[model samples]
Target: MNFDDQPHRRLNQLTGEWVLVSPHRTKRPWQGQEEESDRATLPKYDPACYLCPGNERAGGAVNDQYDGVFVFTNDFSALLPESPDSQPVADGLFVAEPEPGLCRVICYSPRHDLNMARLGTERVAAVVDAWCREYEELGVREDIGYVQIFENRGSVMGCSNPHPHGQIWATGATPMYPASEDARQAVHLREQGSCLLCRYMEQELASSERLIFENDSFVVVVPFWAIWPFETMVLPKVHMTSISEMEGKQRLDLADALVRLGIRYDNLFQTSFPYSMGIHQRPTDGGNYPHWHWHMHFYPPLLRSRSVKKFMVGFEMMAMPQRDLTAEAAAARLRELSETHYLESL
Candidate 1:
């Protein structure tokens, strides 16, 4: 079947959800909203920015003057280490439970102007190392069940700051999405005797259609069931359950993949591409999950241009997630984009 030219639904094997893709709709004119891209240059250090080194944050805490990767408990953490430890209370229809967790922010660089895209591979590798270390430390905690590391870039993605940083939220209970993925991977392993993403990666490698860029350790691809306009997944070439499993070379390779992908994203539309990126790994809830395979997901909003973005509203919110661009087509566009950032290319 010609998926690129027809309307079809693709199954997200990890989540048991379907994404409706109507490739024909791409030909239609878009009279929708167009955002004004932020092209203003950011200073390397902003005294007013709370995340800058040595600056006093809103929480009235002074940051240390660290030169490289810096991590600390979030001044305003979404999750706290302390909470009432009690069983879920049930009274008639209402039920509630106390959730205890810890949230931390990791600054990728001392230079606020440099993001992952602009940061060299060495710098990016430091970020990866920090990620692995954070995962290992946080995952070992008896109270922590899941450690979620994610970054929200650009104002459109609800990122309040432009500083190069990401967050880690370790929770007492696993979140819904990761839990669903764990279930699916477990079932896949039990039924097929192989990792779900490993099998899926084998297929993606076989048919290079959906692949964007790949290194020795990782490959970036627009998933078969991508809902975003340029959604990409970074899968390890080898089977692994968590980031802590990464060795020296694997860490460098993964860093290379991230920087290269970030450059392509920025070069695609000649802007610092906005997206939400996160890592999903094994749960810390003490399960021998050989089925779990760690992967990174990048969900970008841009559609045809830097200003034009995909919006999830109406049917997408009421019904199911849908997209106009086919995954193959998106892959082709990204694959061809110059890895050199557009600003630098000029």
Candidate 2:
């Protein structure tokens, strides 16, 4: 089949979802000259940064001298332990439920200058361990049903601080997005007698076109139906429904994959890449999710350079998500990037 001649193809998996892949588009790489001048360097430590050691936070609480990974309640939490009882308000057209959850921040490193790429595998592994511990602790809460660990990097991603860190939100109910995926996977597993994501991972491995990197226990690839330009997913080669279930070796491999992929992202434009990344796993509400697969999704906005970003406007907001570049092409570009950051070796 001449992929270039085809307008678009909707590849359907065992699950009823479809991804629109337009292979004919020629997404010419943008060369924005202004990005060269806009590159900024972050300091190793900032005296005023709240996340740093000995700095006073918003409520007069001070950060301790945390040398490695640090976990703390968010200074300005979106959700608190003592939220007022749920008050459901219903009108003819309006309805709402009180949203309740706990928000915490995990500092990836003490050094403000260090991003994920420069954090090294050992330190990244430490962060992974912290995540596992947090997940275990939060998941046991009788009220909590879901735990979300996510990172928003770079100023373009609206991150107020340059410190390498991520946020965790443990909620009382499963989110709509993950709930949909869970329902789909459950249906597929009941019908096919196999895990949905495990089968998808096998298919991706066999296709090889979208694969970027692989370790003993993980595979980093651009999904065939990616919406963002540099969107990628990291899947565990071995089927595990949640982070808590991962073996020590698999956990370490996850750390390595994250570090390597993050370094590649930074090297892509010779700038700190802006991205929203998070892990997707089975709900903590406790049901046999043998069919569910754990994975990570990275959505970066930078399309041409550090300054230029892809906007989800017009057709995307009204119609559906669209991308200028094909997933295969983007995968190839990411595959070609070096895992080692250029700045780190210097």
The numbered model that scores best in lDDT is: 1
- The local lDDT score (0 to 100) that residue 175 gets in candidate 2 is 86
Pairs that clash in candidate 1: none
Clashes of each: 0, 0
lDDT of 2 by residue, 1-346 (tens): 5545455744534234554556555654545556453346778889989888778887899988999999999878887664667678898789976667799999999998888888998899999999999999999887788999999998889899889999999888888778877888899899999988888889999999999989999999988778789999999988888898888898889889998999888888888888999988899987678878988999999876777788989877776677767788889999999887878555
lDDT of each: 0.92, 0.84
> Where does candidate 2 have its weakest 10-residue lDDT segment?
10-19
State the lDDT of candidate 1 residue by residue for 48-111, as single tens digits: 9899999999999998998989999997888877555556789998988878898999999989
